[model samples]
Structures are given as C-alpha cells and as structure tokens.
Target chain A: MLNKVEAYFTKELKEKAGILVVLTLLLLVPQYSWRLFFLLLLIASLLPRDVHRGKIKLMVSLPFSKGDVFWISYAFLITIIVITQIIGGAFFNISLSGIGWDILGTLIFSSAYFGIAMISVSLGFGNFGIPFLVLIADSFFGAIGNNWEFTYNLFRSPSGLNPYRMISPIYQGNRFAAFVFAAALLITAYILFERKGTSK
Target chain B: MIVKVENLQKSFSGKFVLNGVSFDVKEGEMFALIGPNGAGKTTTLRCLYGDLTPNGGKIELFGKAFSSKSKERIAVMNEERETFRRLTGGDYVKMWSLLYPKWNDKIFSNFALHYKFDLEQRVETYSIGMKTVFYVALTVASNADVLILDEPTQHLDPLIRNEILKVISNYTLEEKKTIIISSHEIYELEEISTSFAIIKEGKVLYSDTVDDAKASHRLISRDEKASQGEVIGLVGDDTLVKTDKDVGRFPKFEEIVLGYLGGRREFIPF
Candidate 1:
C-alpha cells in the first residue's frame, strides 16, 4: 500500500506540484466563493482525466488492484483538500479553534462534489462537462432558494436553525440527507469504476 | 496451464469486439495471439491483465481465477506503451522498483546500457521504438511469473525488432516464465512462439502448438484437389488444408496464420 502511494506520488509529482501552485494562488484571492469553486474544479478534474487518458491502465498493470487505485486517488485528493484548508485558514487569519468546523464543512461539501464528479465521469461524461453543469445548477438553485420563501423553507433545517450555516450553506436541510446523498453517489461511482473496463 | 481464457466476451458501445475468444498457455511457453489490427488481440490481452473487465467469460492465471493478487504475479506492456510521459526512464525504474516486489535493477541497468537510454530524459521524448523497448525492458525486469505483452514488436526497425523477439524467447526459456504476446508480426512471432492462436474478427480461427499446427496442416497448390483433408484457408492460389495423410507440402507457421486470417476474403481477379 505504501509502495503504491509512493509510486503514485513519484509518477504524478509534476502534476501535483502544478496543482499546489494553482491552489496556493487561489487561496490568495479574497473571495471564499471563488477559491471554493476553483478547488472543486481541481478535485473534479483529478481522477476522471486519468481514466479518460488511459493512465489507469498503467496503474492496474502493476501489482495494484482497481480498489487500491481508487482509494489511493481518493486519499490523495482528501489529503490535498485538508492541507489546502489549513493553508487557506492560516492565510485568512482564522483562529485554529475556529478552523476545525470550517474544515469539516469543506470536507463534506468537497466530498459531495467529488462524488458527483466521479459518478458523472464513470457514466462516460467528460471530466469537466457534467460536473461543471452540476456546479452551475447548484449555484442557480441556491440563489433561487434564497429569494423564494417556499424553496428556502424546503431546504431549511427542520428545527428552523442551522449552527453551521456559515460553513455549509449548501446543506441547509437535514445533514443526514447530505451524508446519504454523498455516500450514495460515492458508492455508485465506486461500483461503476470497479465494474467498468479501464480501456476507456 | 499458466493462463486460461475461456469464452471471453467484450463489447465497446454495444458492438462486440471480442466475441467469445478463448485460449490457454502452458507454463514456460511463448504463446502468441496473432491477428490483424482490430481483431480483438489487444482486447484479449487487456482482459487477461485486468486492464479491462470482460463483459462475460473467465480468465484464470496460475490455475486460479484472476484477481488483484493475480496481478502481482503478472507484468504487462500495453499496446499503447502508456507511461508517465513527464517522468524520466530513471523515475520509472525507481517507481516500478518500489511497486514490483521482484524488480531487478541489474536487468534494467543492463537494458539501459545496451539501448543507450538516457535515464534523465523524459519518456515522451523517446521515439516509439525506444518507448516500446523501454516498456519491454520494464516488464522483463519485473520478474513476474507471467508477462502479457500487446504488440511488443510494433513500430520498430527490423534489427531491434528481431533483438526484442530473441530477448522475449530467451526470457521465457531461461526464466521458465509464461508469456502471452499479441501481435500481427506473424513471421517474427512464428520464429519465437511455441504456441499460437490465430484470431480474426474477434474469433479464434486456429489454435495449437507451432509444431503441431505445421504438422497437421499442408499448403496445397490451387490446381491440386485435396480429397483427404479439411480446407482451412487459401494462400494465394494454393489451398491450406488440414490433413492426416501426407498429401501436400507442410505449411510454414506464417503460411498457416496467413491462410487462416486471409482465407475468408473473396479473392477478386481483375
């Protein structure tokens, strides 16, 4: 497992370095929304492009299993997300005590987007096409829900209160639903990835 | 058997690419899957190495069902020679050394010396022949029990191509390893391959050991009528017939392959 991780790191060192540079530059932006959008774009572009470009063939041809490949990529993406969150918090002068919840919210939000992107890619949607469309739809719905009372009420917490509203405004409804949705998409993507031919 | 593929089926976008392909390789044999382009040779190799999951059928490696653990015993050189393009040859060696438990640095070094490969240069800069050689060298040094190489001799100068074929043949003999190679280079493959399966249009046309196939089949002249043998295919004006009695001249390995693959085409005379 460690060997596989090391192999991936060495193989993708250049791409990873480029990602880090772009991520750091994004963090420098004052707008949190813009930074988050670019971060999601980066995450969405990660695994799908590898599959599309037939890089997965090289990885599977080695001792690594398909599951190993998927989990390693996911782990690497999560690690990047965590590191960038920490860096973003520090850059924004957010106190360490106040950063944990924000980091957790970012993880949840990013995971949901990652799941969407993964399933889209697995279904033969190009890396950027469907995921970008979903992002646009999400923004459109969120904006509409903010203005319309009925739509806003549907997405609002049952208790009429959201403690993490500032962190995760997307999941304004039951957090359980958010978790389930993310889990379902991720599970579907995993199944599709495992069953689908890597020749694509 | 070192490797077994039974009734393997695969399709791309509803079109059957591998329509029930099957073959087996014994231990220490250089088995060749010979076919023209788009004949499902690469697809079969991909399925054998777990690069592509077959839509239906079974693939067994080393007497058991193929799985992730099975991959540990196999090394593959894909048709595309896919690699991390930005990485140098040295980087690949380093990465593979860590990944393959049995990787032999000495073997890789020897290949580098012989090929005069610059370890510092990225893989993308290498010519197609160099890249093919590089991948072949990597697979050989992996020290796996089985090697699945798709189009190993494609896009190479004749001298290097022969050298590569000799290296492949020697590796199987000296290391007692099983190799499943898919290629359209019938003449070269016939020289090295012990067993062969001729595939056409996603189906196996003929499969047997090189010696047995040659012994059982004969190339008869077009004018001669063979009443004692089953007609396999045509080679120019001559007919390739499977026979028990010595009727016509025994077919060369490539003649047999060509007869099987080209036999179906209607000979048009102007």
Candidate 2:
C-alpha cells in the first residue's frame, strides 16, 4: 500500500500539489473565493480516471485493494486541502481557529462529494462528470431555502457572514453529524469501488 | 500448474464475452492465446491478471487462489499503453520495483540499456512503438514468476519485434519464467510458444501443445484424404482438418489458426 501511495504521489499528487498552490494563490483575491470549492471538486474527481486508458485495470492490477486506494486517495486529498487552506488563510489574514474550522467544514463536504463521485464513476459516469454535477447541485441547493438543509448549510460557510471570516467559512450544522455523514459516504464509496472491481 | 483457469465466464450488459473458457499453463511454459478481434482474448488475460474477475470460474496462480498475493507473482504488459503516461520511465520502474519484492535491478538495467529506453523521459514523450518496447522491458525486469502480455508486440517495428521475442525466450530459458502471451502474431507465437489455446467468440476452439496441435492437423486435398478428422476449411478443393492419421507434414502455425477460424466445422475425409 505504501508503494501504491508513492506511485500515486509521484505520478499524480506532485502535479496536483502544484495546482493546489496555484489555487491557493488565487484564493488571496477576495472575488475569486468561490474557486476553493471547485478546487476541492477537482481533487475529488482525480481518483476515478487518473490515467487516460485502462484506469480500472491498472488500479486492480496493483497489489493493494480498492479500499486501500480509496483511503490513500482520501488522505492525500485531505492533506492537500488542509495545507492549502492554511496557506490561503495566512495570506488573507484570517484567524487560525477560523481557518481550522473552515478546513474541517470543507473536509466533510469534500468527503461526501468524493463519495458521490466515486459511486457515480463506478456506475460508469466517468471522471469529472459526477463531481461536476455534484458541485453544481450543491450550489443549487445552497441557493434555495431549507429544502436541502443538509447540503445548503454544508455549502454555506458561517465565516462568510463576518467581515474578518470572509476567507474561512465554517459549516452551520452539528460538526459531529457532518463527520458521521462523511464517514458513511466514504464507506459507501469503498464498497462501490470494491463492487465495481469485482463486477469487471 | 503455474496458472489454471477453469470454466471461466464473463459477461457485459447481459451478453457473454467469455463462456466456460478453461485452460491450464504449466510452471515454466510459454502459453499463447490466439483469436480474432473481440474473441475474448483480452478478457481472458484480464481475468488472469485480476483486472477483470470471472463471474464463474476458478483461477489459481502459483498453486494458490487468485488474490493480491497471486497478483504479485504475475506481471502484465497490457495492450493499452496510454496508462502511466504521467510518469517517466525511471519513476514507473522505481514504483514497479517497489511493488514486486523480488525485483531484479541488474536484469532491469541490462534490458533498459538494450532497449535504448530513456529512463528520465516521461512515457508520453516516447513514440507508441518505443512505449511498447519500454513496457515489455519493464515487465521482464519485474522478474515475476508469470508474465501475462496482451499484444506485446503491437506498434513495434520488426527489429524490436524480434528483439522482444528473443528477450522472452531468454527470460523463459535462463530464469525459468512462465509467459502467457496473447497476440495476433501467429508466427511469433509459433517460434516460442510450447503450448497454446485458440478461442473464438468467447469459446475455446482448440487447446494443446503447439507441436501436437500442428502434427494432429493438416491441409490435404479432398481427393487424397482419409477418415477421422474435423474439416477446418477448404482451399481450392484442399480440405484442412485435425486428423488422427498423419499427413506427410504439418501445416504452418498460421495455416492451422486460419483453418480453425475460417474453416468449416464439419469433418470431411475422402
């Protein structure tokens, strides 16, 4: 599994880290703030089709199980998000606690979105398709009222309500509930990847 | 047996691509898989390498059930070269070496130099032919017990093609490696394969030792043939079949394959 992680790091995450840096730089500009969520979506979408051809074949051929791949990918993603958010917060002069809560809030949403993307990709939705759809749906739900309270509040950062907290927005829901939901989705994604691997 | 696939079955969208395909490969044999396009050759290789699990079948590698450990004993160079495009040859090889416990660094370096592979260059920078050569070299370097290559020589020049075959021969002879290669290159397979299995439309048409399969079948004139063989095809009144009685000589490997694919199934002997 370490070999697989190292492989993914060298082949993919190294480039992704550069992209995250660029995205972080953009976050310093107040107007481009919406780009952060999209950046997370981009990271979530990267797992399904990292290679142009034979992605599933290559993944399954490796010694590690699909669940291992999922967990490694998730860990890498969370690490990237945390690091980038910290950098962005420093540049934007946001409080450390504010940025920490913001990272935690985004982590939950990211995991949920990643899970949905994984399930959809396993169901043949291809990379980028499901993640992009989920991002749009999240924004749409955030725009409406309490109909999609879970998704709406998740996307709506409480920090956005304050002038100083503009760069780092925390979620409004029960933090534990969000974490539990993310865990559930992650397990679902793992099961889906396993099923897809077997189905092939 | 190094690899055993028993009654394998696979389907996509309610259509069976491979149905009850069964074959066994010995510990140190060069097994060839031959078939036309969409003939389930790739599917069979995928199942062997754990890329695609068989819906109903048992696949054993190294005397154990197919699992992550089984995969460690197998190295594959699938026809799809578009993967690993992001990594340089050096990085990819380094990663592969880490994946396999018994990686032969000395052998890998020797082949790397022989193939003129630019270790520092990204795979996407190489031409398609060069990429195939690099992958073949990498798989050999893995030093796994079983090598499963799908269309290993596609997009390669004749020179590299011969070189690849030579490397396979040396790998089998010197290291006692087992190879299960799927390719349309019959002449190439003829030169190296000890045994082979021919499949058509997801069904095994024939499976036997190369020498026996060739000796058991021949192309003879309908007017001169005797009884007890399956007629494969007709060529200008000459009937091709797998016969019990020996024709004066054996047919070429290509002749036998073409016979099985295009010939009539009925046995006709004069």
Candidate 3:
C-alpha cells in the first residue's frame, strides 16, 4: 500500500511537470498572477487519474476509505503549493520569510483549488469547473475585500491591472476566512455536481 | 466452496436479460456457463464479480452472503477489457494487483518472468492471447479461491490455449480452487467440465453433471429417411431421430455426433 501510493504520484500520474509549469509561471512572469497557479493546481487535483473506467474503479477501490481519498487528494494539492513557494524563494534570492505574502497567497490558492476540484470532480464534474469555481471565488472574494475591515490592510494594495485584486487568497487577522472561502466553494461545487446521477 | 446465485434478475426496460437464474457451484469443480450470445452468461458473471448490479437476487460465497468485500475471494477478467495502450505489460499486471486485496507481487511477477514475459514491453503491442495471459496471470498470482473468467480463450493459438487450460486444470485438481468460466469453446469445456450449465437466449437451458448430459439424451438416427426418433429439436435434410433417453453406445458427445451423422439404419438396438 505504501508503494502503491508512491506509485500513484510517480508512475501512475505525471505530476512533477505540472508542478514545475505552475512554478515557472509564478516566478518568471513580470506581472504576478495566482490564477494560473490556481488553474494548474485545480487540473492536477481534479482530473481523472485513470482514464479507463475499470482502472478508475480499481483506483477508487484501493484500501482507502472515502475520507482517506478526500484528504490525501487534499495533501497532494498542498504539496504543489509548497513546492512552488520553495522554488519562488530560490529564484528571488530570498529565504522563506522574505517571500511571506507569496507563500501565504499560494497556500490560500492551493486550498481553494483543491477543495473545489475535489468536490466537483469526485462528484463527476470536469476540468472546466476548475476555472469556473476560481472565478466565482475571485468575484466573491473581491466583494469581501471591498466590504470587510481586513483586506484593506493585508494586501499592500495591488499595483495597477493586478490579478490579486480578484480574491483575498489571504487576509491577515481573519485568516480562517480562507478556510470558509474554500469550504463554501467546495460545498457549492459538491451540490451542483452531485445533482448528476450515478446510474452509469 | 459453495457459490449460490439466488434468483438473479437483471433487465433493461421491461426485457429481462437475466431472469431468476440460480445455481450452486461446488468447490474444485470445473463449471462453465455455456450460452449463446446475449444469453446472460456474461451478465451473470459480471454480477457475481460485483461489476454489475442485478435488479434483484444475490450471490452467496461459501456460507456467507456476497458483498463488495466478498470480491477479495474472486478475480474477474472482463470479456473485452480496455487494455491501457501506454503502460508496459508488467506495469499493467501490477496495476491489476493493486486493485486486488490479496495481491502477491512476488508470485505473479515471478510467473511473468517464468513465462518469459517482458515486463518492459507495452501491452498495445501484445497479441490478444498474451493479453489474456496477462489478465489471467495477475488473477492466478493473487491466490484467490474463485476465478471468474469470461470468454477465456477468445483469441489464443492452439498451444497457448492448451497452456491456459492446463493451468486451469492444475488449479482445480491440485489446489482445489473453484472456477466459473464462460466461453464458446465447448470442446474445451467438454474436456475439463465436471458440472455445466447450458444457457441460450439469456436464460439457462439446463444445468447438470457431465455424466447426466451423456445419460439423459440419446441420439437416434438412421440412413433411411423412413426412420424416426423422439426428440425436441432436430435439424438437417437427412432423416435424423433424437431422443432424451439413456442410450448404451452413444454415451459421449463425439459418439452421439457420429451416431447422428454416420450411423447405419438399425431396426432396433437393445
């Protein structure tokens, strides 16, 4: 079972390049955009790990409870976030603390990406839901940013045409709100996707 | 091991593909679900393997009732398995093993090498017979008590076909494993099958011991068109008589076929 899980990341799924692609976009691009990173993470987490119907059934049947699958999938999404942060820190010639806001933003984005993707895809939605949910979160988070007490202080206010304005991937004091954002979008995705039948 | 299929009923729309089919398969016996196309043999096997859900009925393994967990005792090879074109043959087998709860890697992998299987070779390039062996080897290595093989010999050369049969015979006679196999290879079934079920047009025609099949039907034939024998279904231009009565000489199916085709007219055989 240990080897099986290892194999899933290594052999079964080619995840390393996906992680690398997200990192390259995050670090090298002149204008900062968390959306692309979020998008990549969404696809990595949600896509059917196995295309064959039988193989898909087999993967789901691994000695894993439904909860185990849900959380492990969550952890893999986070790993991507961590990898990106470490890489960004290296490229910026700074240590972890110097790149604090970027790390925080990535974490927030990762959780939101995973929560929504897991809910939607497990409930049988497709890759499109990744961008859709992220867009909804961006709008809703922007609404919160304008109305709330904290977002004004947490982000240093975006430079013009900045993509970060769309969502408070992180707000300083009420950081717990990130979880709320993730959970709400996830719940919505679940509700919508679950409406489809399991007859097939 | 006792496999009791209780009132299995599955249908699409109002048509019942499998209607109330039930049978008990005993341990160490070669059982074939002989049926024409669409006769529910595959459907019944699918339900037994937990791949399909019947509208009604249940399967019992040993004395316990069947459940999803009960699948650990069985390995199923689908009739037309979608072979992964990208993965190597070894990896393909390994993936199947991961799905198996009792998956023993050493035993299965060793057998692959013993068969001179190149694990590095991709499955898309494999012949249909090699692919079948790939599926079967994974199951056999799991040491599962029950093997549900559908159309096991669909595309095998004669020698490879014999190899598979030999493997099956060893498992049943030596290891005392139970098997439920469905195939059109009637001649092979006739050789190894102890108890058999005949299914046609999505229903079971009959199920009984091989000896019973031999004793229950008599082929009555004569060269003379005037001669006649009591039977349910008889076909052909020549006059042929068939009867479901015990006969002395035509005890085996080969003899029965020969008796039907090439026998001389006889006034009586007592």
Candidate 4:
C-alpha cells in the first residue's frame, strides 16, 4: 500500500506539471492574497483530471479496490498540499499563528475539494471542466452572503468571530460543525464513486 | 470449475451489451470466447475479471465471491492499450511488479531478453505491435492463476504473433494455468484452445469442447434447403447439422464456425 501511494505520487508529479507550476506561482502573491492563493492551490491540487477513466480502470483492476485507489490518491494530494504550505510559509515568513491557521484551513478546504473531485470524476464529469465549474460555483455562492456559508465558505479562511464561518483556523467557532460537514462530503463522495465503480 | 458465471447481464444506457450471458471454465482449460465485433465478447470478459459489475447474475472464482482477492490472482490484457504511455517499458513493469503480488522478476527478465523487448524506450515510442507485445509480456510475467486476454494478437506481425503464442503455450503447459482468451482469431484459437464458446448479440450460441463441438456438428451439401438433424446454420447451399449418427466426418473448426454463424437457424443448446 505504501508502494502504491508512492507510485501514485510519482504519477501525479509527471501528469500534473501544470497544476504544480500554478501552485508555485501562487507563492509570489502578496500576503493578503495568501488566503485565496492557498485555497486555489488546494483546490487545484485535488483536481481529479490527473487520473483519467482509462487509468482508473487499470488501477482498479489491480490488486486494489476502487476505494483503495481513491484513498491512496487522496493521501498523495494531501501530502502535496502540506509540502506546498511548508514552502509557502517559509517564503512568506508567516507567523506561528498564521501557519497554524493556514494548516487547519487548508485541511478543511482540501477535504471539500477532494470530495468534489471524486464525485465529479466518478460521475463522468470530464476532469478539465470540473475545477473550473467548482470555482464558479464557489464565487457565486460566496457572493450570496453567509446564508450559503457551508457551501460558499467551504474554501474560505476561518474566522474566529463569525459564527457563520463555523470552521476557522484560530478560535473555535463551530469547528465541530465544520468537521462534520467535511466528513459528510468525504463520505458522500466515497459512496458515489464506489457505486459508479460498478462495471459498465 | 475454476470460473462460473450464471445469468450474467450487463447494459449501457439501456442498450443491452450482455443479455444473460453465462458460461463455465474448468480448471486448466484454455477457454476461447469467439464472436464478431459488438457481440459482447469484451463485455463478458470484463465481467469475468470483475472490471465491470454485471447488472444481474453471479460470478464465482475458486468457489468464492469475486472481489479484489479474485483480481489478485487474475492478470488481464484488455483490448485497449490505455496504459500510462509516458512511462518507459522498464518503469511500467516495475510499477506492475509492485502491484502484483506474484510478479516473477527472474522469469520476466529472461523472457524480455528472449523476446528482445525494449525496456529503455517509453511506451509512446513503441509501435502498436510493440505495445501489444510489451503489455502481454507484462501480464504473463505477473504469474497470476488466471489470465484473461482480449484480442491478444490484434496488431501483431506474423512472426511476433507466433512467438507470443509459443510463449503463452509454454506457460500454460508448464504452469497448468487457466486462460480465458477472447479473440476473432478462430484458427489460432483452434491450435491451443481446449474448449470455446460462440456468442452473438449478447448470448451464447454454442459452448462445448473443441472435439465435442466438432464431433456433434457436421457440414453436408443437401438439396431442397432442409434444416434437418438439428440444423445449426447454413452457408450458401451447405447446411450445418448436429446429429447423433456418424455423418462420415465433421468439418474443420473454421468451417463449423462459419456454418453456425452463416446458418439462419436458431438452436439454443442451453
């Protein structure tokens, strides 16, 4: 399983050069842009397009099941996100509080992104169109106010005072609810992908 | 039996690809699935390997339910070469060795040398024939219990094709491995296959051992176009008849196949 995870990471590195380059460029952005940059890169790293339907079929046909492939890829993407954050933190000279908040925020954001990518790819939404559509949906909902907080603020930086922003980096503002939301999304994605995995 | 598929059905968007297709492959037998294009051969094979779940029916391997454990013992060569084309041949094999528990490095190295496989070149650089050979080699090297090959000779030159067949035959002979090969190459199949199934339009038209099938069905030039003696089918003026009585001798494997396919009679021997 460890070998499989390493193989997936190597494969992603070779296949997702564009995503890596975009994530690298995010480091040069100003401090204020760090929130958006981190979110964008988190979402970008989780784009399911790196593994196509053919590759999925091949992978699933191996000694691993569909869930195995999903979780392995999930672990790989999460690692990439962590490494990127480490590099970004060093370059931007973020304070301890900022780094702590960024890590938590990135985890929640990545969980949501991972869920969306899994559902999109498994449900036959072409990989290229999904991330673009996700960004659009996020902005649309974000513009609608806190009423759609759970949906719109999925990738936003956590706020300590804002109750609507249940999942934040610093102060615990309904952080439990945020974790539950993330868990729900991840579980739903797993169920849908496993169901869609039924042979055609 | 090593493989048992009962009432297997599959469809895509309401269009039936396999309508209750079923067959059993005994241990150590080379079972050939012969059918024309769009005849559900590939779909059936996919179902057997659990690559695709059937809409209905049961598939058992080694008397247990099918799952990843079944997949571990099965090595498949699909019709499409949709592999990671960016990886070099050596890298691809290395990746597979990690995934397949029974991978045999020594045997693979020996076979690669004997076949002159290019391990240094990326898959994209290889010709279609080379790609086919490379993947087939990878599958064979996995040393799985069951091997499912779909159109293994699709894009191969005659020399390479013969060499591959020789290697496969040697593997089966030595290992007693069960092989399920789906191909349009009937004559090639006749050379190695112990039994075969002829399917059309998502249904099994005939399933029997090569000798039994030949012994039961005979080609006769009869007048008045009579569909007699359990008429299998017809081709031009000849009629293919399956009878208990000796009709001199049965036709060749290809002749019997053409007779059954071309003949207009529907004989369901389930």
DockQ numbers for every candidate? Answer: 0.68, 0.36, 0.10, 0.44
Q: Itemize residue pairs with steric clashes in candidate 1.
A: none
Candidate 2's C-alpha runs over 4 A off are A14-18, A24-36, A49-56, A59-65, A86-101, A126-129, A132-172, A197-200, B235-237, B246-248, B265-270
lDDT of 2 by residue, A39-117 (tens): 5545554675552223656666655556656787777777767776787788788898988877777787777777777
Where is model 1 more than 4 Å wrong at Cα? A28-31, A140-169, A172-176, B264-266
User: Which is the winner by lDDT between candidate 1 and candidate 4?
Assistant: 1
Estimate the TM-score of every prediction. Answer: 0.92, 0.83, 0.66, 0.86
lDDT of 1 by residue, A1-200 (tens): 79889887666666557776776577556465786687676776577778766677778888878788877877777777777778777888989975786666666666767777777777777777787777776665654435657856777567655433322335435555556666666777788888875557
Q: Write the per-residue lDDT of candidate 4 for residues B156-264, one digit (tens) a residue.
A: 9999899888777766788899889999888788888888888889988888899998888777776633344787777555677887666634778877777766667
Scored by DockQ, the top model is 1
The residue pairs in collision within model 3 are B39-B202
Best by TM-score: 1
State each model's CA lDDT, in order.
0.81, 0.74, 0.61, 0.73
DockQ of 2: 0.36
- Ranking of all predicted structures according to DockQ, beginning with the best and ending with the worst: 1, 4, 2, 3
Query: 1 or 2: which has the higher TM-score?
Result: 1
TM-score of 3: 0.66
Cα lDDT of candidate 2 equals 0.74
